[model samples]
Structures are given as structure tokens and as C-alpha cells.
Target: MFAIFLFVPARADAAFCKTGETVTLEGEIIIPPVIDGGEWFWPGKFAKRPCQVTTLRGKGTLPKECAVGKRMSLTGRVLDAGIVTLEVASIRCY
Candidate 1:
């Protein structure tokens, strides 16, 4: 007798973040999920999992559209995924 099996493809995981680096982020900007959960990023893919934004790097300026202490979805490319720094591209209020 012969048997058939199915295999699933694995997706690439985001690189680990560290201090002095940038990272893309999304999901809720909650308070204290981790110290500075809304401030300091947890660092991961927002699409597949939860992510955090620790420092904005003062790249340009704070977003006026999205208010602090509110759930939001953000999309930006990571300059450095290590230690989680992000350059905010777009945001959607929830």
C-alpha cells in the first residue's frame, strides 16, 4: 500500500530587534503590555503576530491623525528590526 502526505510551506520570520535599530510595527497601542508597550516596541510582524514601537526616532514629527492611548494599525518599513525602531508610513485608527 502507498500513502500520500501534504506539507505546508514555512513563512520567513522577522529578525530580532535591539537597541539603535528600526522595525516595522502594527496592532494595538496598548498601555503596559510590556514596559512601554505602546512606547517601546515588542518587535515582530504585525500581520502574523503582535509588534511594538519603542522609539519614533523623532524622524520627522508625531502623527496628528492618530491619538495617543488609542488602538491603531500602523505600517512602516523597519530601518532596523533589532531593538525595534520604526519609520511610520501609515496608520489607521480603530
Candidate 2:
């Protein structure tokens, strides 16, 4: 009886993404323009851009290449429906 239940699929199963897959997302990476450590940046050349990936927590997505204000295409491994983990992630700025 317990074995039967174990194999049964839930009537309503909601999951973000079921598999770990890699996909290339093209967008400008941007940093929020707000005070983090009691400081705000002026919107100018120095300020970050929309398509820039400044800092990456994990591997691949290189900060040196994906700097502020660059329209880039990045490949990421999907961790969830709206979340993705970078694995050997690379970017191309356009």
C-alpha cells in the first residue's frame, strides 16, 4: 500500500524547472541604482548599464568580460523556473 503511494504523482505539482539545463539568455545585466552601504552612484558613464553582469557569485560568468553597461548574451544552467546557475557560463557583448 505504501509502495503504491510512493509512485503516485501529485494531483497538483508545481515546480519551476524539473531539469538542470543550460540556456543562453540575452539581456543587459544591471545593478540596482540604490543605496547599499550608505552610498549612491550618479547616473553617468561610471554607473552600471542595463546589459552588464558586474559580479558573479559562482564560476564561468567572468566579471572582467561582463562589466557594467554591456549588452551581453550569457549561458546559464537552470536551477529553477526563474533561477539559473552558471556552469562554465560565457557572455558575448553586442
- Best candidate according to lDDT: 1
lDDT of each: 0.46, 0.39
| Candidate 1: C-alpha lDDT | 0.46
Model 1 CA deviation exceeding 4 Å by range: 1-24, 30-48, 57-65, 81-83
lDDT of 1 by residue, 1-94 (tens): 9999888668555444444433444555443222332343332334323344444332333345445466556556545555455555655555
Q: How would you encode candidate 2's per-residue C-alpha lDDT over 11-94 as one tens digit per residue? A: 432223223655454545465333346332222222122222222223322445554577656554545333323322555655
User: Would you estimate the TM-scores of all the predictions?
Assistant: 0.37, 0.38
